[model samples]
Target chain A: MYTTMSSSTTTTTSPSKPQFRNKLVSSLNDIFVFVGGAILALLLLWSFCSFVSPNSTITFNISSPTRPKPTKLVEPTNSETTPPMNCAQNELAHDPPDHTFYDDPTLTYTIDQKPIKNWDQKRQHWLAHHPSLAQPDRILLITGSQPGPCKSPVGDHLLLRFFKNKVDYCRIHGHDIFYNNALLHPKMTTFWAKLPAVRSAMVAHPEAEWIWWVDSDAAFTDMDFKLPLSRYANHNLIVHGWPNMVYEERSWVSLNAGVFLIRNSQWAMEFIHAWAGMGPQTPNYSQWSKTQKATLPDKLYPEADDQSGLIYLLLEENQKWADKIYLEHEFYFEGYWKEIVGSLRNVSDKYLEMERRSTAGGRG
Target chain B: MYTTMSSSTTTTTSPSKPQFRNKLVSSLNDIFVFVGGAILALLLLWSFCSFVSPNSTITFNISSPTRPKPTKLVEPTNSETTPPMNCAQNELAHDPPDHTFYDDPTLTYTIDQKPIKNWDQKRQHWLAHHPSLAQPDRILLITGSQPGPCKSPVGDHLLLRFFKNKVDYCRIHGHDIFYNNALLHPKMTTFWAKLPAVRSAMVAHPEAEWIWWVDSDAAFTDMDFKLPLSRYANHNLIVHGWPNMVYEERSWVSLNAGVFLIRNSQWAMEFIHAWAGMGPQTPNYSQWSKTQKATLPDKLYPEADDQSGLIYLLLEENQKWADKIYLEHEFYFEGYWKEIVGSLRNVSDKYLEMERRSTAGGRG
Candidate 1:
């Protein structure tokens, strides 16, 4: 009676169900268990392998036998010493043995004994190892300014062209050039502007070995004239000076600072800072003034500027500065702005000739 | 005979040597001896005082009388425990008492027991204390691009103007903007470009708390609509989506990723890295192609772009990503490029009105 009722219900509700479907469902359960077990086993093995030797699993199977074995544990030695009882004891035990009392007659410090107190010796030692001091790596910072207060014969565009020409010249010599229209420091003016400009350029171009300041009015008449580094072997500054003005007359305007080369060393940086301090910005600037007749009797010229300040430092402060300063009379650094403009046509041929020679050498 | 010779030499060198000079020299010598003895005694006293009470050199006399008499030496305590014998023993003794093997089961690890395995909970805990998540300090980085390959109806300059208009809209709503002309990553295209652009903007503007990328093709039709931070209080990303496309259709083109806001967060940076990995530059990118029907049957679209990759990640990857993502349908995020351009005339009046209101408010 139950079988007849089940058949009647199936007929009324659904007709697709068969005894084969029930058999298939029973078989699927075994397959599901096998697949699930496989996945679980794999996951466990992966986790275990990862925990045992992290990062080794990727190339574990393929690595050759010659590969270095894992570091072996070292056995404790009988000769090993005992550690200190406390942190203070450990510090005292580990303190460097080289540092002894200065008054100890038995021990002597070679560095202290050496006469390194001299500024020239210290500067030479520092410059010898400076990373950027390589011959080719030297940087020539060619700065020119057409500030608002300063009047120029040429237009702004022409002034830019003149600076660009200087840039081209430096580039050909394998040196970096930084040119800006405005003065680097606000307080700096006229010849004094060059000091801050060179200082800032040194700061900006850390890789540069030297800083060369060419005034806005100054033109490169001798494009072929390559600055021989040998000439500045022991010098930090290179400027033009007339013997009559520098030695005999002892004039404030003895040295022309319009076009000069300054080594981009710490000494030059310090010197530039000192020179800038003596400008109109400082309290001691009145002492540097030509009008201060009682104080600066020799600097009676109206145009006593940063040049005069540099001269005062060289003459009064230290002989070491005088020794490092190269008073070059070999080259004509600059002439009057009018004279430079007039000679540009004549110098253009020399510039072209130098460019041709450089190009030809590069090609060869 | 020696005394007579010295006297004869002195008389020959100085004929007018007076007796008063000898008396003056003797008196000066006596005064020097007295002053030197006093100075040496004072120095000895000062040194002894310094040794007895170190750190009392400054304000030695001004300190309060009640200030504890410079600490007196104390005898060693008999109750003190013995120190470890060696480094190994010291290490064992110093090991934190709480850390023990898990199998011992006596101690419990709170971290292991907590549900930190759940990424969403972990992320929430991390983001809660993050400084950039502060509400008022939030910086919105708005970026758009006019890439080289993409052609626009208006000139590139006008496209820039359109982006600038969006910048103005965001600025009025109190947000920063970063505009760029090209894709940050060379290999990225279409929506893929947005990833690198957003990443770079995050790096460039560190002060920005969020980055909102608006496509060059998109425009701000509702300039008055301001996005309140509260809307995305718990969300890391905010994009527009339709319910039908997001759920039922599960279409790759469901959400508009063109104009979306991403929080400037560590989580966002990681997400961007993952997103960029799916671009054409990566080795796994070939798996995204629809032509490989056997592997990627679901991604059958010819243009399987960045949007498609994002949709794939959402559907197949973690649900935590979806929880953090806010899919808003409140307002339209993007329209067809042509439609946006066409509606510019209508939106100009609203923009002008908002500008006037802002100006009046600013003035008041």
Candidate 2:
């Protein structure tokens, strides 16, 4: 059976506009004479008065007793418990916070009569505000031809679970292809070379103070990691883990895609745009993976992964544009299976405690 | 001046169906008595009569004086100079002889009363049979932010140089962000992902076979690639590329995302559905910069990226579902810049020669 998605169209009819005809006009000289004499003087005077007068308005909203508010009045039904299926409490079960959030006047939220499970109103709003939201400036992500069993829970599931909710995210599942037989990690950096996700967002949302990129499984000790919408009130790239917190540098220490934010500053957008264009042989990452292995400092490691490739990109191109890169310590943290789980659990515990405390207060 | 992009909000008006009068029909027996005793008996008798009597007619088409014969219609206004820009053209633009085979018909094809600049009606027909042509399934090539760099000769120049007569190939400068990036990719893989042009054709004429996705730069070399439409028939993903070509034993082979054919095949759609899924925390890739060193690869890659991720997933999980993934090597060659550009250039030269020869023949 075909399922119906949301509808966004309506048809309305309106009465035709009234037509008027003017009497025959004089010739060009006569027309000028008509305007140049008393009529022109009166027009000029009227224009000056309209410009100077505070009361002057192009149009007026004339309200009358007969004109009613457009709001649809809700009639009290005879049945107390019964409601339309769309308005049923069952659907609200998924969104109980609506009851709480609605009470918070600060949020200034309007509840949709029908909470569509499929359509994202927030995304819709963002899209409408920035028509470009639907089409991305650039889509940057990692891809592999043959991914291994991936001893690391790093590819799809882990990636999706962590970040899918924070923002608009899509996980493309390419066939199990690897640059180097699942040995080398997904060096999305090379692919990002072509995709311009970062630069695009800045251009698309000028009002957005900052644009952050976070990997799915990256751990956040506190939900405070949510970049304050006002953080870089003025635009600038607020990358963490990068050295000196500058636009360029090999220290690449800035927050990993694991968590990096752009202040939507001119410097950041220009930097990203320049970067997408300048590259060699388009960086045949597939071939490179086959030959090179990852080595941390003194030891050479087999199977360079997503992390290693990132390090390589940051380091190999360090001298050319190192100064622009900035490293943030707050964003730099070790990534591991246990650590991620621990962080998630810690966040969960805090949430539970908050809930418990709130409930107790309510009871008191 | 702002030029509107080629996209329409398909407002699906779900005709509100009256809720059935179920209060009286709660009992199955009562429902059967009401339906079976009257309508069912009459239908049964009618069926028996049709089955028993050879003269009893069932199949019928409305015949009226007002009905215009299909052949009696006037030739399209552009018929002499251009081909129909109908949905069928969109579908045919993606199909076989047009994209894969040696017999080139597109060179002669015209559209909207104008000879297609670089492409022919043959290509249009190819797209008609392949619904996926205009619908970019995996890889999205977005230009700089804003719908038209109507000003930026950068991307436009590149596309024009590559796809000749193909003007609407790249969605445009930053229009990519207008449609939800993740949603569009998923739709491409799922039921909704066909070229809008092709969809229009299907609406105009439903009997077309497939949809083809061939960029202006793409060209047939050996014409050895057998169109996959023959095997899968409807909604099939057909292409020619080196498959099972392992990159260091990872079973890696790159295919041309620009020139792949898709028929309305269940397998093709399932592959797309299987490929599309949104994950949380996909980086706001809109800001990724070439200068930026790779950060976390696994973390940043979002779902619905260029089909590479999906390809990786398919291969990784092949043992679990091998039957669904078919390798259509005959129809698509890897259009990687390094490997195919030379051959493509050679083909372009040949095309020029062919064009000259045709002109000479026409003159003779």
Candidate 3:
């Protein structure tokens, strides 16, 4: 319309002889009628073609009250197609129609119990059904304290800040977090409680690749830092450890089980089964403690701890599990608050200086 | 193939004279050939029809490694048609292509400042683009504590449990949560801090209808009970109140301001502006305190509190904001820990008894 109006204006603005202009006007009117009819015919043909072609029929619409947006229906199980708009309003509420491992009535999500088999295949099936949440390095932080109130009056307060810190870190990193105070197994007390919680979380959040167990006592001092998941691509479990220190000190609690990233896999499940065998729930608990104590005697504490059990596993079954277990020695995962608090200022100043340099360079 | 095999088996089983059977078989073969030719032609026609009809071609497939699950490309912004599979692995990473209020140069998410107009329309557009998160009653629990450690030795630990309790409730209810200790606006201290935090949450989560402010000091005693959001459909803001108590006792803190449910609407934005206008940041802060003290003559304390200011607002601006503000007298939003704790065991026991009755009834 704009082009036609501009063309008409151009013809009118240009100077012309009166008789010639009159003749030209009549000719132009006849041509206009003919062109208009032709254009109308072309539009009709285009409309007919569009009616037959479903893909080509979706025209650009903005605030057109006459039409709701174009939509396509999707079967719940088929990740092959997503719901056009509201299909996955229940996105997190997705349970693919085609049965995965959940269909097997025999399958249990319990810890230190029956082991899960063919998890990789089952996980693939799950991923195929829920591609929206199938990122390989997605983490789910699991942390919790005892069910009862803190013995120390100020204990609960400290816990709140620590939990808050974890929540902050998880939110910033787009990771899911679970804080449970329930004791899943009565016998699996203290550190052994992690097993049932981790197992349950694994079954609950198939979308997450790693069930990150950040101990309730620990805190995320540097909120800006994110877990470098890609660095442990080959490994399924990662824990902060100094093996040389373990050898030198000959201490039971060498590796800080306080914070660790364990992959949601069949191997991890098996490792958990082996590790939890040392807990009070098992028949060999006393024997395992004796074995561990004989290896590395400690004067202050004597009961077989979860951390100590893991150390025993690494030392005893080095050939079997060490290949998939990553000892994160380069960075400290957890430390004393007094030790970590002082360096925070330096870290903050360094970050600020880097920011200034980047800003200056950008201005230039 | 199964059908054909069954037909051959039937032919073999049926008794007949050898010579007559042979002639019958030849005759049957001729008839079969003619019918088969017709079927083959029909199959060809059907395949051609399926090729044209896009929707008809998706056949049931199980464990077919030969074909990667069916997939289609998606233009991210167009919720009209979602990507077939991997298109929304970045579902949480959604940013529709259309320009929203966020695109406006002068817009700010800061509290008690520039007001957002046409928020209903803006939220509508956002919901349209993100139908997946467009639940009308979806909640975003906003709670926090002081940035510094609690002065009491066990203060931090108590805060952690309260936060965890909130987390547990939010998780079970399928609601998102945000915990921020950062002072967004410098002068908004103590109770005044909620306004900034609420405003920030409203901007951050356009998906949620209600920015539920549950104070860090409060915890959900009833885990089974969900906020009956449908009950507050007509109201934009809901806070627990005892109007009769306020009238009779004439205390400064008549109603508990520890917990409230405020809807994410333009009305809320305006309410925040009006409410924060009486904060420490404003020149009338002292005057407002004096006004509140005059209204609620309390002997214990005289300083203006957020709860007292709220009471003053209710008394002074009864006609203006009262209609949208629901004073929930039917149930308590918050209460003292000691007051709430005594009834918890009875509540749990009743629930257990009800469950037992239901199970027995089901078996019968």
Candidate 4:
């Protein structure tokens, strides 16, 4: 997501004296508090704009909502090629279909890919696969549960609309079912509290290939999420969020977990286990409030959570995976709400038109 | 988790030409690659030493084998003095007796209190009425499915042994489980390949709390693990292993997710939902080969899984639950593991003695 907001104003404070170091530490805390407050202010402003002047424009160029459609739907050339194995088939014939596979199951999913043209297909595909999620792929969508003004039927509507029509089977108690009782539970901030729900959701839907999460406020924007969906379905992680193209500073990149994906594969599961497991090296609460100023402007600066704990974890993963885990650019759009919403609404309208055409044309 | 070595060696480079500033806008990708690596390297090394090093030591003056005993059972004398009813009890008591809150069903019930303790006899007494945890808490430990020399079982055993008798209950699942089942798919690094199995395990056990993790080689030697267990059962996070008090330079402390914790609470569930529903923020693949330059460090400096992800997520949670979320201190003697494996056998033996004594003493 691109934006033209000014970076955090950095005014160098000349060192007063050797004794001022202690004073500086105290002052740094104040500064961070101020920064935090400023961030809150910025967020408040953004929220107001999002609510009141939701169509505000900002300077940034996201990808155009242009994409190519599949030339044709080829019949199953051979049983080996299209014989349904575990319901993992291309999206062409399945009554609803898997939204994750794009049009083709073999597409190397990327965030930048633009194959999905409409929300109906996307929602339908997800609904079909929601019930058919692989046993290991059942997911627990932990909601903030604040019951704030923003949370609306749209939240539940999105899930139901997306999952009902598309999904044919789900890993509910190891049984394939189109739908099951929607499980609702209170949200927990602690890893321990969430583990059981996550585990059970995964266990019940072992057939689910990926555990999907959607924030209450987020609405689908069409370009094609299948590419990113497939790609995210492959990463093993407890968490992965969007990283903004704009840099507040070197160490930090803007991040949003609002729309991130996680792989339900064994490694990813263990990564979650490892994260939520015992014997973690806890941060020092007493001294964490203190801060030391960075020396260079180019130093990497993490944004809040990005700074608090991610840096350490990412450092370790870097050692292991090197260049594997990351945030997507195209999938997460923050600024220029007017443009994004415009894109989203335009794509949605196009999708509805295409749906009507397909229905009238029969299953051809 | 303390280390005396500092790997930040000075590197001499030619003075930058003035044009470098002109290219700053364009070179952000390059500059970040370098800066992110160095900072992450420092943080990772520090985190590893603080949490990963079983033999690492901190400078705290706590007794070696005299770990604090679990808080004495708080027996409320007067039932009439009980606090008013609220949902906090249900929220806090999200886990059941099966996994984390391992207790007789008759004993595990909700109570009214400001700050709930894990084993408050008064609360337990009150819990008899609210036998309503049809939804049990469970933990799913996740790890990137990197095929490294780091043996999975070694890591699994480390975790199993640490929380063996301390936690209420737990189970271990590895990447091989998902791979053998043919669900071995990953999107980010090969390390992400392991998530499927963990998710599967979680699906199987919907009624469990706190998935604990430990790196293959990490060790745990302590006076007693009662505090650690209760804390994990309480906060529900990817807790760190241990910290090195003597280490001054390193500030960002985290235990390897190889040994962390997660909650089954609402916040955690929401996080999982968001991850699965939305395609995750993808990493910058353009910097895939940037691992060559020592100065540039790896583009994936902070790997975005397990520890880092948890840290990131929980830090965000901390904003909501600041006082409630906690990270423990690094003790000097029992920090990680030194050469005290067999030496601590007596400690475990003594723990057994204490357990027997407490049981024999019988809720006095």
Better of 1 and 3 by lDDT: 3
TM-score of chain A of 2: 0.36
Over B1-364, each residue of candidate 1 has an lDDT whose tens digit, in order, gives: 0011000000010011122211212211100000100010000000000011111111111011111111110111121222212211111112122311211323211111211123333334433433222234345444444323112112232233233345434422334444443334445544565676676555433334577776543445443233545557798877766656756677654666666788766667666766666677666677755522222334444544566666655666646477788876654444333223333443344334544564455322
Listed for each candidate, the true contacts retained, as a fraction, are 0.00, 0.00, 0.10, 0.00
What's the ranking of the predictions by lDDT, best on top? Answer: 3, 1, 4, 2
lDDT of 3 by residue, B234-312 (tens): 8998887777766677655566665788999998988888888888878888897778767876624445657776776
Off by over 4 Å in 1: A1-137, A146-154, A181-183, A290-304, A337-364, B1-364
Chain B TM-score for the candidates in order: 0.53, 0.37, 0.72, 0.36
Candidate 1 backbone clash number: 0
DockQ numbers for every candidate?
0.01, 0.01, 0.05, 0.01
Interface RMSD of each: 39.5, 34.7, 23.4, 29.6
lDDT of 2 by residue, A170-243 (tens): 11100000011111112222223112334433333332334554332232232111122232344343333444
Alpha-carbon runs more than 4 Å astray in model 2: A1-163, A167-195, A204-207, A216-225, A228-235, A240-255, A277-326, A331-337, B1-364
What is the Cα-based lDDT of residue A122 in candidate 2? 34
Please give, for residues A142-201, the per-residue lDDT of candidate 3 as tens digits: 877565555444445445645665665564445667776656666776566777778777
Residue lDDT tens for model 4, A193-260: 22323333333333344444333223322211122233344455423333332222323233333333
lDDT of 1 by residue, A1-364 (tens): 0011000000000011122111211211100000100010000000000011111111111111111111110111211122212210111112122221211333211111211123333334433443223233254555544332112111232233234335334422334454433444444554565665666555434334677876543434332234555547788888767656665666655776667788866677567766666676566676657433332346544434666666667666656578888886544443333223333343444334544564455322
TM-score for chain A, candidates 1 onward in order: 0.54, 0.36, 0.72, 0.38
TM-score of each: 0.31, 0.25, 0.61, 0.25
- For candidate 4, the per-residue lDDT at B352 reads 49
